[model samples]
Target: MTVIEIDGLSKNYGADKAVDGVCLRVEQGEIFGIAGPNGAGKTTVVECASGLRRRDGGNLRVLGLDPQNDRRRLLQRIGVQLQEASLPGAIKVGEALRMYASFYDKPADWRELMDEWGLTDKRRAGFASLSGGWKQRLFIALALVGNPEVVFLDELTTGLDPSARRTTWGLIRNMRERGVTIVMVTHFMDEAAALCDRIAIIDRGRVAAEGSPRELIAKGRADSLEDAFLVLTGGETA
Candidate 1:
């Protein structure tokens, strides 16, 4: 049950390749991760898969539909939380959620989502007034509002506090339990090792290495995922 498939996928920025002849597959209901250092093609590849960017070459399919050609259907069935998302500063938390919910034919309950994301007290707060963690939580809640079968999360915990990060991780696990597939892009090795079923380590516009956390670590002959990633990518650990 492959939910996503990429064959020799490539994306170019002017003359430079951002994603170069990459191939990967994500199974249905699995938590797949794309990990890499800065300047790597992780973002490019995920953006291509999400149909936000058109690929320069190769084939890509999401749930058996061509991502670029069948974008309308794909967009309806998949949720995306981009690395940098912007909302109107004057929009209240609840207003924002309701606006996003309107885009979907069937959406989750806004009230329940507010409480679950610990956003109840901040429901009336303006987007500008919310803390970094609260904003991140709201983004997560919005992404899930559509009850999408597959979700793309990029740097989801980037600005969250330690407790908030853990809380978001728990919510991600809950999404998995509900049979939702997740495609996550992150620089955090610990998050990848802990949550990902399979990880693709991309570097210099290509997949440098890929496997389960244990398999990757074993292949690198490293003690931990961080050490393995550093050894493989030749980059410093965060």
Candidate 2:
């Protein structure tokens, strides 16, 4: 099912056009990827779709409801982890998760969420005291606490080490198995190729190209998605 639909979606910041006439359709129960070079307005597109930012023009819908008009209703069914999402330094892991759970009408058991994400041991740890990987684990657990149908993960593993990144990838795969639809944004083409069911390459506030990993490579006549990204985006590196 098409859980998200955007048509000619546009958002501007000052005189700069952050997103311009961008259109996309995201199916349910799939990991959709939004990828691009820095400053390509990838995050802005998601913010508008998730109802965190108001668009200057065009329209968008999530789960058949307008993001702008049905934001309050939608919040109960969707979760969002922004690229720069963070909590107060002094907050404890358990405290953060519990607090997030309280916002929803029907929430998951936060304690089980902690154990499921391997965060039980870190429950007492302060946000500033945890490692990078631990913090990310907490973030994902918090996102899922609302028992959402859709979750947006922006730059999910930007700074993790190889092992931690792989571990996080496993967690994402597990989410898919449990029937959660995901929208992921990433700079790493390899990660997108590995995890995404479909990907859209955004550039200059618009979609440059979109398809499955192999289809995209075939379309660009490149050996890899990274190479295909460079080819499809006119030499812009992702």
Residue-level lDDT of model 1, residues 174-195, one tens digit each, is 9999999999998888899889
Candidates in order have lDDT scores of: 0.90, 0.91
Off by over 4 Å in 1: 236-238
Clashing pairs in 2: none
Question: Can you write out model 2's per-residue Cα lDDT over 196-233, one digit (the tens) per residue?
Answer: 99999999999999999999999899899999999988
Q: What TM-score does structure 1 among the candidates reach? A: 0.96
Worst 10 residues of 1 by lDDT: 229-238
Off by over 4 Å in 2: 236-238
